[model samples]
Target chain A: MSKNLHTSAPDTDTAIDRNVPEFPVAQDSDEQNYFKTNQPPSYLDQLHKSTKEFIQFHKDQGKGRKVVLVTSGGTTVPLENNTVRFIDNFSAGTRGATSAEYFLENGYAVIFLHREFSLLPYSRHYSHTTNCFLDYMTEINGELRIDPKYSETMHKVYKKYNDARDQNLLLLLPFTTVNQYLFSLREISKLLNLVGGRALFYLAAAVSDFFLPHSKLPEHKIQAQDHNGGKLVVNLDPVPKFLRRLVDSWAPGSLITSFKLETDKSILIKKSNQALDRYNHQLVIGNLLQTRKKEVVFVTKDPKIEPEWFRLSDEEVEKGVDIESLIIPAVIKVHEDWIKNHE
Target chain B: MSKNLHTSAPDTDTAIDRNVPEFPVAQDSDEQNYFKTNQPPSYLDQLHKSTKEFIQFHKDQGKGRKVVLVTSGGTTVPLENNTVRFIDNFSAGTRGATSAEYFLENGYAVIFLHREFSLLPYSRHYSHTTNCFLDYMTEINGELRIDPKYSETMHKVYKKYNDARDQNLLLLLPFTTVNQYLFSLREISKLLNLVGGRALFYLAAAVSDFFLPHSKLPEHKIQAQDHNGGKLVVNLDPVPKFLRRLVDSWAPGSLITSFKLETDKSILIKKSNQALDRYNHQLVIGNLLQTRKKEVVFVTKDPKIEPEWFRLSDEEVEKGVDIESLIIPAVIKVHEDWIKNHE
Candidate 1:
């Protein structure tokens, strides 16, 4: 792949083509040094700083602690002309959020990289907490008047939120769009490296495959009427497969799981197998689109046991069943069994 | 599947089993009266009402128009305890909603069955058109600061929305779950039947595969608790393939299009071909997960011509390119070209 960099500085452009090693040596005097000079820190920078501090504090407290990284939601694609639009998907980010809760319950340190506009209750911030309560009350009342069955479901959700509040184990890094997801994942991976190899990555985000390859930062707003009757087209370059690459590049021999949804049974198996084969994943949970409850087939590289399919019933489905039921036990069994066999 | 209808009725020692034809008819006055007076309408009856109303309204206009139904979003699984949780993908419902706009723009009456919490803006109601001077000022200021490229893209979205508004050709059915989606699809299908095949169905939604079977509705609010430290197991039955069934049962000859997102080149071809084989769809568009822009391979069943792949550029990605560019033109060209050749 050619290194195509876009820049506006004329002198630097010439230097860039020459591939000068001392590119950073010449600094333009007019260019305001945002980082060098003391200025009020941006919200995002502050967030990063705080997160770093928290990790250090935790590291000081202990070793051999498990840190799980959970990523959720869909990424955004920038159309040509710099305007951004989101790729469409059916994910409300529910399963990812729920799984995060399960991880926290099991006493793992969590770093959640979530998407924008997720339906999951992310933070215990006062406003969000209040909204949750209101949602709970409204659901309770609505259920009471409507079918009692619906009411029962709402009650379970209410209880889950309450429990989450008590646990207080969530850390949220919210974003929208595919680029944001990629960047956040990379940033979190770096943080994990800083903290050591205790990181476990659960890639649950649904990333968009396409995006505008070239985008110009707009200085002014353009009107809808300006581009009348003219052809406007975007050339999309393929996005890098970050999840597959992450497992390969960052965390070797660490627990990594990926999800694949298929409409066909044979295809689902094929894809799950493919995920495991390509990524060296410990487990790949596959589900079909025909049903709402998860009936997953677990695929592992370990040759001792045959692949197992676990089906959830209606009763079990409503109880907010954790993927951990399958994930935890399988992981534990794999470790224990492997130890026994190897020893 | 065994027919087991358990009806709840007061004053009966046991639930009413409708499946047993030879069971003694217990004429409990309270139960019999309740069943007689307060029974909900049948699925078919509800279907008929919605279909008749839609068809009659369209026919009364005498526009000689076609109607298309586009269902978008993920469905939920209702557990036995009557609690419902969403089993969703990362779709924001943009394609479906945008396609609805396109159909309306081209003078087709559209019934858009959208899932809950989609980011796409619905057809604007008159009430939302505020004429505040401050709003205009804010808009102008926002436009002034727009990036040129982004402004261009915004112009297109605005133009499309305006054109759709002027055309007044969209109808919406907001939905959130698979059951609701199925119910709505069936209703629209009936309406299309009434229209004498002037309807096209787009199976664009990322519908989930598994659903809760035989879950009871909750009568009261349930508290959240971790399942007791015993292994919690669930059993899931396979859900019937509704999309495949729709293609087979309802509209055999209607123009159909489907999508397949693949991670690898080989699988992309395999899945695209499989979709065509299973549903006999007119067109199947395959996209790769690594592609940044919409790089699609179009496949058809015709033996003479091979499939074509369109590689879009970054510029084109910004203008919100049409899926029909690959689907509609190919469909029209194939049918037309085939007719000429045959003649």
Candidate 2:
């Protein structure tokens, strides 16, 4: 029924489907073996305890507010167990953090699982930039206060932060390594399943598709002296397609939305549609790495539906309007429809 | 006449000198060639302007206040030009930033060249932690204020921040990739050299020892699909030892101190002494990754002098006394003697 698997593209490189496994082609069962082989992260017990508490607290409130679990930033794949060096994906967590604020604004409690020290929803206004935290404050009359130039924005961010905390709408969990990310993702998805249709998964994290399994990594730092004539060879196993399991088993009732980031202009829509078909997820938000902040395309699975584009106007960009504000409302509408139709 | 090269250690593995070139050995001149092969970073012009301005500003002040250029945090080595993935060294920039604060406290105008988003001197009180920045703040009667529990320490950090900025004692220059770091380091070193013996270099940044040359890297993201049966081979040239150049040519009169981090306890001293001999720099601060904050060894080249240990006592550790407080005073004493001997 899917017609565009290898449709003619505007570019010659369309023949290479980079995401699909071809060499020693991996099957779905390999993903199960991956979890069986690798040890679960040490933080799993702590995360489970926190997740259970968060879910129960929301249930006790009985506000019937939707819960969105937003994953942000990039997961690192360590080259060694002692981890002197590791490969990191390039992401600042701006999309995820900004979207979290919008989600919180529109009656959703957020579970923000992000890379440590990347960015937080309300704190995104000041933290994780080149600007020193002290730059935001001024000494006025022998007392420290927010600088007058930034007082207006600072006040807005501060109040929202307090409100979110007081209302118990924001819960933060952090992850660093790829192994920790996978373990936490599975645990969190299952935990959120307790809410059934009310749970939404926004998978914005740039996870590494390939990683050296913990078993293969050296116990100490990798020595540069051993490289064969300056050539360093690293073996990485494809991180199994956990998305299928995520849709089928874990959090099956939640509305799942994942992102597709591409550098090429020609294959963006085609690849996004392919992911939608493969995972059978509700939506794939497609973005280019360069223009991600200004524009994104919404690719849904229904054959008759055309892809939707949500873009920021130049004036909106000039006015400091986040594109996530527009994206979240559209996602909410889709979530509302999914809940109704599933019932 | 260095006597302690590979002094018998507690372990048999002590024979392996990890830093020694075993593969295709790279020479000192190859570093200069490597810089020419790679395109200079886009921000080079901007950084040069800032460095020039900062130096001129320091010169404009007649106090002849000793200037310290403290390099902090880890430098990343990108695997590709578009840079979807990079290998990162392990550092949170605590040592460099803490040392900078003590330097400023002891009357040195400081230039902080740090990894972007890593800790800053006075602002280290609040930023780059798992806790949200908002956690340190509270609102009462619609007025934003530092949380009362943290206000005492926050007040101290805040006042020092105001003092540093007001007196123009701090200049911050941030870098991300190794290429940018090398470029900036050279430029800043040269600029600091304009003041001759008055400058001090505290090199604490965890710089990468290996990197794929820019000419060898792919223009786009490195595709995982083409891995030879899950094995990814990456060829990395040894990062040229620029320390020798720094000691011999760039800022030769400055008192230079570098760091050596080792996981193996036995090799720590041997390696530290090797660096001091090879670079012929003034000092090498040796630390183990695990107990870096609690203790360090100060290695000097004077054959009669034994390696000095500056350690934190249990009581001092319990009291949250930073070992840098001790380390800085010792370094200052060394700096004072160096200045005196030169005069």
Candidate 3:
């Protein structure tokens, strides 16, 4: 048996961070160097302008224009620069999209940062994975009309969507790779931070924890040709936990809420605690992979506070009710308290 | 560099194939053994039943019914059992989806085996990535109707979709993992095989060329904990080319058309020709990654035939015409010739 191995030398990555001074977040060595080394997304400037416009729109509406940055969907980690293939996390952005709608209903302007082609706020009612959009409309009297079966729910959704658009309360932005997501997160955090306690960071996106640096990535698509029974080996560096920077510097004075997803039951609360302790973020929502849609546990930064559980009943599940309906209002209360404390 | 190398020995896969008789594609050893080593998709039986019913529907209708299996979108290769991360190919199934619409229009029954949430035939008009459905609709006197801007085109698409449903001319089935796709392809191929030359195999799906065998995958999500600044390594085995088995056994008398996508212009035709030589399939369509939407070259199995270029003009591009509208007709013509020659 012949063996062919594809690998990268890790000695280069570990050698130390000697020259990291260009960006802020200087205390975190790896994350600070990440920006210096990697190229920002192509549309970073446009994204910044749009974000500023969203905040300014709220400011013009007079006092108490609370804005929430809703980061949704999963980020991909490309193995090659040309990217015929990439490592993707299992997420459809249901949590963030659902929460964004609820936030809007509660009169909070939303900045929806999402993965391309994942579910969105109003459109989630008629998702792409389910029945085709055409199925919901029937031709009658030379005009297409909404099917009576779906008209009631869709009409309500359509009205809400119109109100959102008319009020300019929703800003939709897309990111594909982990780098794009990270860079945009920084820009958004900085923009929202200026709004101070009026801003809230609802970080629900399923960010990849590992990524392959540009230096190691192949220029073209990885060839699948067998080299005497070959194996394609991919070495990925740990994606620096930028939540630290978000809590400490990026979005200071804002209520930062993040998620902790675990497959193991015993380690769920423990891991959530570690994140809260490490970043001292306002809240860490802990949920297991299998039951995330129905249940979640909130672990707060206050050491004396106990974890709180939130769940939906079987009847709610049968009725196709989203658990986010409960989750967002509770977070709003916490955010309200946060603003009061800071004031 | 303190390298924490994660690897698997290749001696395990390199040994001579044993116990491959159970599968019919035993003429090719690796593909036959692939089925033995891997578990069939959980829904394989249901998929088989559904596919058979589609074919039987055409048979029960009348004579001279031509059926085409249109496989679309990209298949994912899971890196772990719990599958927090997966290797995904970049495809939205535009070609296959667009071509299926054309096929149904040309009086052919289509079995659309597509990736979950990918673009569909009529639904491609309202893709999830493009615009929210609510954006395409309007309320007039408390009644929601298709927006006038999109009304004309959408009405046409809607009528065509209703025709498809009334006639039962289209069957839509979805696959996620590459294994599920492969298993379903084999079953669909055999079902279509009995129709002989009247059946056409349009293999447009972007299947992964490499996969991780279950023997090596981790049970849970790959942890991002830095082991002294650790690098995560993944080894993938080359996926065995199943075209050989598909042509020779699975769909013996069907017209097999496949696609070759390349980023490098220099190697495109040469590699495509190599595949033609290896598989002896009826046709291979070669296109570069950037130009796939506009231009493609048809490489036939016959050496005497020159490579044919089929491209849309700049005017056509400006008018928003799909290249598949042209490609599918040409393919249908080729299939017609194939059927006549066999007769």
Candidate 4:
């Protein structure tokens, strides 16, 4: 349990733990109740048909290459049915968007399930930064052209984005609420299973841990004065552990990689290890909130194997090297190994 | 009190109500205590310096032209000091940003106090729409240029945005939490007082009605199982009514227009009139949640005067006529009349 990064394990030859912990039977009914009680996303029919087409197109285009389902952004938990207010997680989805680009570059088709208005794979390169989108444009002689300072980078990003669209390597789906996110995830997991173990699930979205059934919420906006002494109180139930169902029943024999984000760095690796043990997943990428943009530690199943840290050098960071460029490659390596082992 | 739009009243000659309701002295100490307890934003010094400079620059640029402080987007109620989760209002800043542009077009310098990363006045013409920002760009012979389909509109937007920046007619200041927004509003209201009766306050931001003092929230993320029956319960106090303070002392004699949004249409006009009566502000722009983008009602003092509706016809909407185009001009007319009457 050495917490130091890049430490070599003395017992590298220790066999990996193959035991699957018994599924949390107590929560299975709770999860089932969640799905039975909640309504599905509005555009689910279209999402399903389009996703099938995307997977089939790539399958016909190439036989043995991998496919990744990348979930990004933060899902909302609405406080009321009419939804004047909601609890939201603060995430810009930089990790998921950047990782999708790397996955596409690595020749894997990507299904990007993201929060509706959060960042996207290529468009994120321009918008939502310090400069406004209009800053890139200029009117010269009645023609609208990008400023010279940005044209080169814009061209490269646009070229890759265009390729992804034209070659059928990417599919974009948007979800707003945690309810929609969970339901879509369950359905998409079944669709991704068509590819067998060759599929990789990159669960990066900041899914809420707490939620309320639709019946529990007020029919209209909460009145501030009607509550206790002009105060508001919210009672929320825990969203069932859907990851267990995701790993156990929905996408059987698939490679699932989840992210563990912690504010305290002291317990980051330990919790990541626990997640792997509990869910029996392939990998857990552990990151601290403070240094997540620059570094991450990979936590695998074997207790004897010291967790490997991936980091961007200060020089590389200054040069604008994205850490996702490294994490994606590491993930693909294990994913490919899993595919080969399953075969 | 007919709810129908554009209904005219026979009592047109009735004198506008000059009676000011006695101020709620009870909440004055409550507001002061709240301000004393909450921390100001991190960038207070920079924001203060820039805002002062912006007001002075606009003053020297013109003698009698009115200046507007436009607050846009929605504020957050952070659940924790570190802020992993929070309550958020669902606002895209469409109403605020769109109105700011019209304000500028009417020859007024605008200080846009907005939520960080929300839509902006000129840049909003292209970004945050259904299409991605990259969709507007085309790679032509290794040059990044505007796509032909969007060039005309892009050029128009770029020209206006460029003009605003070059003339110092727009100053952008950003805030995230309700704490920062309230603090900034109080500070900016003081500075705006320098312009005397010429300053107009357009309070359009969807500030949170409920908030919690930092001392009340847990220091870390709320763990699910640690709570009763795996549920989370949050208690939040109502944000103090700052509009009363804004009218009586902060910017005395200024023309203040505040927006009142309601989901229940039956109560919309009644609440708007009550707000005007309670705050003694010049105008209350009342809007329904469903039809706000297309229509609004102007609620002034003298309940005898019927509310006047501003709307966009179907043909006008089809031709892309922004409702703000109509609303802003009407607002300007009332503002101008208010200035003349005060003189």
Candidate 5:
């Protein structure tokens, strides 16, 4: 086997920041440099305008309602410019979508940033992996109607969706690639800074930890025949640590909560604590992938208090009670206290 | 940079055929050995049972109806046993789903083997990437009803779907991984062989060309921090070439049509011809990745005849006529001819 690696700077007139040490230890500079080097998604301007419009609408009401930004699903890292292949994170966006509905129910203006085609709030109950949306609809006398068995629940979801739209309480923004997610995240956080302490950021998207930066990747699809013995070596750069900047600068007054999902239970809390210590964020929710729907441990900034556990009872599991139903209220209580402390 | 790689035999009772000279040039041996080595998906038994039931249903009718098996969408190649990241091919399953509708309209029993949650035959018109399905429905007097704008088309699609189901002319099967696809493909081909010349196989799935074989991957998710400089080298074996075996042995008498999708137009026909020469398959529909929806070229065994181009007219394109609507009819005509010639 042979190792073949070469890197070139991105072809752009935009002056990239070069004042950092090699390997970039500073979080803010890394984020700023990343944005300078890479181009944002084409639709970013339109998304920014729409989000601004939603923000203005809420402000006009003069109620000072809390605005929560919920990021959901998994972001993809493209291997080629044409993107014949990509590395995808495993997520269905169920936690974020379901939790968004609860946040809305708790009288918060919700902004949903989700992967394209992933689950959405109010639509989650009807759409599962196996059943087509059409399966729930049937035609009667040339009129399309929801299947009788599904109508009652569908009606409730429909009413909530309409109410949210009518009151202008929900905004949905979508992202697919890692670059798009990062760009959108920065723009959204900066926009929410205007709301000050009334803002909350629920960062739940399963973001790619590493990416093949533009300098390392080829412009076209990678050719299969180029490698010896069918070996493909990919060198990826660690994603710039942006949460530190989000907490310190971008949305300094907003209560930020990020999740750490691990397959192994042993390191979940330890990793969560490390993230909190490093970033100085308000909270880190640690969860094991296998038991995520049943239990979660919340780690906060206070050193005096131990990590708190939230778990659904076996009977509650059998009764189909979502763990988010329990998790959100506890977080709401913490958010209330944080607001009072900041005020 | 260092090339860190070592090969080891799979730890299983499965007798993997190691006799094939390293990277055997023949397609069939590569395919046969792939199945011999890798474990089939656990769901194969259920899929086999359903497919057998479909075959028996057709046989019991005693009408000698032609049956076509259409494979669609892209198959994932997992890099780990508990997959956190995987390589995904670029496909939406539009071609196969649209073509299946035409096959059903043309008096054929259709079996749709597709990626889970991809486009489906009658439901394609309603499901878009951005819109929630609930957007199409509105509450009228507390009853859920399709919005009037979409009602007419929804009625037509609904009627067609119900008619197909009532007639027992459609069987929808799903697969997400390459392993599941290969196993299901072999089983379906062998079962369809019982119907002889009356069976047609439409191979339209964008299958992964290379995969990280089980021998090379670990049972856990690959960590980004484990590697020096975050360099991940993945060695993927060429996907076992199965078309040769499909044409020669599994479903020999069945009329087979496969698709070749390339980004470059220069080598499109060349690659199609190469596949035909190597596999001895019936037809290869050559399409460019960018203009596939607007145009396609048909390449058959006869070199004397020029390759036929199927293009959607500007007026038809404006009126939302899919290219598959045109392509499927032409392919069906050729299948009819082949049936006569074989008889």
Candidate 6:
């Protein structure tokens, strides 16, 4: 068994060895050689490349341009079953969306995170645009017939939608629950990290405070059963205050604006002040919804400048209210003053 | 012919003389009736009928009940053109509707004067209902859904649309702008006068402050023109404060409740108190809508018991925490306490 030449032979010195020699591998290769030698790039790689290119292009254009992030509408909350609930409000997105466009018209990139039934047109021509889609499953009406001059607006929106569909951007995370809204806010906060200091976040979303605390996502579609004759007694949990958290966690230098809609003049002013104090926000826009005219009182922490309230007549408050003329100038002025004083 | 027929003519002459007086008297039979034979019923008739019915119904049911009138939603203003202008809000009729139902549940007859887009279900089951029709058109999915429940709610609304061939309520009065809202409110006030003091009025309509200062109803239908690509700048005039007018015009001892929603707590209380002072209202429901849960503070002009604030949790709030609970109970308690103390 050890020495038969015809069968197998250990040639004189061949033995079981502990140490074995291995050949050196190449770390780098030319493009042509690599293509020939390796597998094709994955879909993820192409997506990453495209996203990087888009980001780089935007970054280049965004230089010297202020950026605004406007959150609009009411968040929906999902129930135990597949059925969803919403913290519905009568916000036509008139104030926020209009303000956003005003900001964009004044040379700012707007990232609009809007909820369903928004009356403001998310035009693409406003330079840079991005939407945090939340109501994809919810059906929307046909495209609105807008002025043809707003072609750029249309193009930008189409591009954003296409990119979202292609997974070039993060697909909108749908939330119908308060907890989900909180989660979405947290996720948005993480995304804010990439925005750096050039970001101006306007939190105008009417987030609900109470949601089904014990709701559980169904593993499968549950059969429609009228539980207690469709009279549901939902036990609601207190939602975590995101605005309070945003002010607490974010850097103090960040410019944040909060809105307060009130009926009483004095109460609205006081609330605006409290908002400034609680959030450390640069400005608080307070308005009374009961009145026809969109009169807003801007409150800031600045001591030397008395808090000024600007009243926009109904005509002035119409769709074309120039944000630059009315409120933004004050905001910019305050910013300039703050910089001057701090420096 | 004269002599022989004279005898027969004498009878004819006598008959003719009876018809025509010697002094050329006027025809008594043909005389225009200065006094109306069938006069329409008056407030006295209504009072008699109501009293009889009230006594009979109480005798049959063996119970005494209070009556409440709740007015919810926005009113419209009439323009110079056939089209009307609306001053509306995003109220879903949740608060006012729920409070009306609460009154009903508490064995009180409710007169619900609701505007368009109200969530209150229209049924004959209600003790007495009156729907105040405002000339506002709401377009949903490109199709108009006119407020059809108008007839079930009010008699005046029935008279407005009853003659029209088109059953569509939108066609009855075309609301083009905010001016129409003022006109509508004026008409509603006239109707309110008919309701009398046995009713409690709740002013929950979010009325607009400014109206189209100059709007003319076109002799013919104004062809829809895209004015400067639909960028029309409308001039607005200030609308008269209806709540104040309502407070002044309402019958004495009528329990009136006004609402004020604010973002600041201290301001809300102060404003609510001021509302009490200005309007001399029995109670003011002050709510803060910053959070999802509607925590409302009720303020009354109770000299003995100090103003108290109650915080409802999310669940309780969502369960439709109504001002009626506080209102009805407090009203009953105050009346009872007054009786006991006076006795």
True contacts kept of each: 0.00, 0.37, 0.36, 0.40, 0.27, 0.00
Better of 1 and 5 by lDDT: 5
TM-score, cand. 4: 0.91
> Which scores higher on DockQ, 4 or 6?
4
Which portions of model 6 miss their true places by more than 4 Å? Answer: A1-57, A78-80, A122-180, A214-234, A250-252, A314-325, A335-343, B1-343
lDDT of 3 by residue, A1-343 (tens): 0011112223322212112111112257788789988999989999999999889878777367899999988999987777777889888889989999999999999999999988899988798546887889897888877888888888899999999999899999999999999999999999997789999999999998778776666666544332243445566676777887888888879999999888878778877887776777889999988899999999997768899999999999999899999899999999999999998
* lDDT score of residue B98 within candidate 4: 98
lDDT of candidate 5 over B78-188, digit per residue (tens):
877777677778787899889999999999999899988778888777664577777888877767788888888788888888889889999999998888899999999
lDDT of 2 by residue, A1-343 (tens): 2433434333223211233332233365687778888888887899999888988888778566789999999999887777777878898999999999999999898999999988889899888766788887777777777778887778789888888888888989999988888889999999999888889999999998877776677676554453224434444567877887889889899999999988776878987887876788889999988889999999999888898999999999999899998999999999998888776
Residues A1-343, model 5: lDDT tens digits: 0111112332222111112112223456677789988888999999899998887777678478888999999998877776767778878899999999999999989999998878899888766557766788876665678888888888888999888888989999999999999999999999998888888989989997766676555555443332234434344566887888898898999999999988767668777887887788989989877888999999997989899999999999999999999988988888898889988
Model 1 / residue B63 / CA error / Å: 4.1
User: Over all chains combined, what TM-score does candidate 3 have?
Assistant: 0.91
Give me the runs in candidate 1 sitting further than 4 Å from their true place: A1-47, A50-115, A119-343, B1-63, B80-84, B121-159, B162-167, B216-234, B318-343
Docking class of 5: acceptable
TM-score of chain B of 6: 0.52
Count backbone overlaps in model 4: 0
Worst 10 residues of 1 chain B by lDDT: B125-134
Q: What is the TM-score ranking, best to worst?
A: 2, 4, 3, 5, 1, 6
Model 4 bad stretches (over 4 Å): A1-26, A225-228, B1-26, B225-228
Candidate 5 runs further than 4 Å off: A1-27, A226-228, B1-29, B224-228
Model 1 root mean square deviation, Cα atoms: 23.3
TM values, all candidates: 0.43, 0.92, 0.91, 0.91, 0.90, 0.36
TM-score of 6: 0.36
How does candidate 5 score on lDDT?
A: 0.80
Candidate 1, after superposition: displacement of residue B305 in Å?
Answer: 3.0
**Model 2: per-residue lDDT, tens digit, B1-343?**
2333323332213211233342233366677797789778788888889887877788778356788899999999887677777878888899999999999999988999999888889888788766778787777677777778877787789888889988988988888888888989988899888777788899999998777777677666544343234534444556778888888888898999998887878878877887887778999999988889999999999989999999999999999999999999998889888877776
Q: Docking quality tier of candidate 4? A: acceptable
Pull out the clashing pairs in model 5.
none
Model 6, A221-280: lDDT tens digits are 111221112111222233434565565563344467777765445456765776566556
